[model samples]
Target: MLRFQDWQENQREVFFPDTVAFKWQMIETFIDGEEYDRSHVITESKWLAEHVKQGEIGAQEEYKHYKFNFSGNGQIEVISNGFTVKM
Candidate 1:
């Protein structure tokens, strides 16, 4: 999951990026290690592009950065072809 802020002081609550960038990169920093309370996504990912250029991933498929931030927990990041949310 990504680090998503349910509520910001001056900005509207953002659940995800306005536009999906389709990229993924692992982040290794967190203020605290605890349970995850939110998630977010970023499109037009640069990480995916780098991997494509390095031949680490295929160019035929599209991937997006999936961030699962620990709400109260290391932020885990990964690349996904696609995702769906079921409330």
Candidate 2:
């Protein structure tokens, strides 16, 4: 599991607040790439399905496609088992 937090910066201080958080379980693959317009998770991913059909991945393994979007920065797309909301 990985934890990503959003922070605030000012003249007084640069601090991290537990406002918005991202917790991901990147069990299969992790890719940091350019921003994607699609901003959501794709369950029972076709992307992974293709790999499975092609014998790249085992049929026994289950994976989900997770896409995280940062305001201006590029996005990160990961193939994980699943994720939960921690608040």
**Which model scores highest in lDDT?**
1
Clashing pairs in model 2?
A: none
TM-score (C-alpha, index-matched) for candidate 2: 0.44
**C-alpha lDDT of candidate 1 relative to the true structure:** 0.51
Q: Residue by residue across 1-87, what tens digits does model 1's lDDT show?
A: 233334343322323322233333344443343335455554565666777778766788656666666443335556666554422
* Clash count of each predicted structure: 18, 0
The local lDDT score (0 to 100) that residue 36 gets in candidate 1 is 52
lDDT of 2 by residue, 22-72 (tens): 343333333354333334665556766776788766788655556765454
Candidate 1 residues lying further than 4 Å off, grouped into runs, are 1-36, 83-87
lDDT of 1 at 70: 49
